[model samples]
Target: MTEIALRAEGLYKVFGRQPQEAVERLRAGASRDEVRPATAAVIDASFEVRSGEIFVVMGLSGSGKSTLIRMLNGLLDATAGEVELCGERLTGASAAQVRGLRRRRVSMVFQHFALLPHRTVLDNVAYALEVRGVAKDERLEAARRTVDLVGLSGWEDKLPGELSGGMRQRVGLARALTADTDVLLMDEAFSALDPLIRREMQEQLVELQSALGKTIVFITHDLNEAMFLGDRIAVMRDGRIVQIGTPEDILTDPANDYVAQFVQDVDRARVLTASSVMEPARATVSASSGPRAALKVMRDLQTSAVYVVGRDRVLTGVVRDQDAIRLLRAGTTGLASITHDDFASVSVDTPLSELFVPAVESPLPLAVTDDRNRLLGVVPRVTLLAALGNVSSHTGELPTVEPPPTVPITVMSEALDAADAESGRAVPSGAQEGAV
Candidate 1:
């Protein structure tokens, strides 16, 4: 079985005056009104984060995303239930236990960089190691390496004031990296940067994640950023998880009206790819072949279009069955006379989004090709639709409506008669004749 890096089961946290009493009252069946003045946080939430997975908890402000991250690292104790980190229970752990876990096993990067104004970037990163009792020289060396890893190689001696907002966040990331924890929790880590800088930071984080593979729980309110960074996003609404799935799953198949509205504006093609839509290519004929031979080939393949390749089997263009028909009617001598540049082509690496505008502008099927234009396969509209359907079905967003149950007239009458007998009701003579 895959090891879970973090697990929270029936976790509930409420902050207010007499919180314990409020919880007791609620457990005893008192309504929210009875606990209204005291309850300030989450309620009965559960999820697990697999080791090395980027599990994102995303929501608008006050939806409990921040509170959940804090509770994960034991910054705030759960009012009820348990939180386990790397197999260690945290719900009722002592302050020392929580502190030890924070120091050695988990680290967090917040929206604010939190770098000390007096410390240089190098010292800011080295602070975590210094507190852990490493020698000055060793801590400095480790910090330098971590700084380099986050693309801050030369900014080490500068104070936070000397760096841009993005650079300051890099310092914050370096600090966490220097701690060498198994899990990293990021709370709106790039939301403060300008759009351009935020994009750059997100890309940098993706690159870093690919290399590090640390179990990460990134909290963000931005849906686009969440889609880009998360392997699986847990969308929170009104203190509950509305849906959880991959970016492709969420965009193609939303779980409810809220989730559907959230993903409505997303460009589906940019998110879907060729590998998700391409079908195996069937055998085809060359454009230079005789028109009669090409017609026979099309008929044998049962295809409307045949991919035309050269002597080396490199794709030159496509020939349609209509072209063959026209050529045969006109008594054309060769396939070259019928071939035309009416087909659309795309590289295998091209994003599915790139094909949308062109596909709308033309009726031709999009051909998948290699860098050298060698035909790989074709993407038909039906294939794209089927792929979307598959994605939707897998994500539980699209309902699979079953056909209504069929009942014979005799069976219906028998059921009615049984109900009448149970009620001690008389059955009319006309009703018995109708049942027959």
Candidate 2:
């Protein structure tokens, strides 16, 4: 089981003269408007960040996401409730203990690059160690390695002013990493960068996480960023958590109308994966099977082609009815002579957005494979379009499709119409034979 790196139970952060009393009243079902003077920055927020997971807290401005993150790091005191970091209580811990925890266990990267103007990149990164009273040479050595890790190697000697906005942000990231903490609290860390730079940073962060395995609680208002970065997301509204789910869950089964509208604009193709819409490849024949057998299976399943799998369900190639019949008539008993390996294939984790080009190009349905290239399922063009069409009904608006490069919009529209017309009959009624 994964370890819980950070946990918040019954967290509430009220700002007013009588905060605790306000919490009691709010607990008794008092609405936010009723507690007028006392603003509830966070109300009954509870969630856990597991080890090596990116847990995103997402909400618009004034939704208490920032406040909730601040309280997690002990930067702000919660009016009521407790917080634990790595199994250590942080809510009532002394200032020194909290400082020690921050120094060794958790580090934060802010929206604005918080590098020192007068200090060089190396010095700014080493500052985290300096506060811990590490020898200057040792801290600089550690900072040098961290600077290289963040891709700002030669720029270590330059002042903050000498670097670009993205570079400065890298320096800030290096500083947080210099501490070598197990957890990172990134409050809108990439929000300040331009769109292109922000995407690059997000990708870099994912790469870094894969290598470093740091538990991250990323706070962001951008839904796209959250979907791209989060293992799971907690959506906030009016200082309360409205929904907590995976990107697909939030898109497909929103908890309320508010969440539905919030995610209406999200690109569904990017969020939905092949596994969500894939069906058992109804027609499949063994590679060792003869062309006559392949043709029989195809005819029985009412499919033009049948996927050919070797031992252990590893996909070898595909056999078309015409080719099989031709081979059979030409006295070819084995499928080895006629099997076509030119069909398109994608991993089960592939997003629906990537299926269009392959779906358009492949004569057969796109094959879904595992790491071992074993055929797990198949995604038909009709199934892919039907899934995208379903996206419109859920969002209450036409899906915003940016047709892939080479696939025309008119072609997608026609396919979508056919899919809608064939609704429940997406997958043909055939027995799943030899499917793993």
Best model number under lDDT: 2
Cα lDDT tens digits for candidate 1, 1-436: 9889899887777887787777677667675556888764666678999988888888888888898888999988888879888998877989989888888788999898988999999999999998889999999999999999999998998989999999999999999989988889999999999999999998988888889888889999998888878889998876667888987778767899999888777666666677557776664677568654664554454445677777656777667655665555554567776666667777775677677655444343467878777777777655565555555323445434332222333443454466457557775554434211
Give the 10-residue window scoring lowest on summed lDDT in candidate 1: 399-408
Q: lDDT at 118 for candidate 1?
A: 98
Tell me the TM-score of model 1: 0.71
Candidate 2 has a TM-score of 0.87
Number of clashes in model 1? 1
Model 2, runs deviating above 4 Å:
330-332, 391-436
What is the per-residue lDDT of model 2 for residues 1-436, given as tens digits with 9 covering 90 to 100?
8899999999999997789888998899998778879899999999988999999999999999999999998999989899999999999999999998998889999999878899999999999999999999999999999899989989988999999889999999999988888889999999999999999899999999989998999999999999999889999999999999988888888999999999988888998898878888877899889865775575555556789999999999988766765665555579988888888999988999999999877766789999999999998776777777763333445534342222232332333334435453342333223211
Model 1's alpha-carbon lDDT is: 0.76
Which candidate gets the maximum TM-score versus the true structure?
A: 2
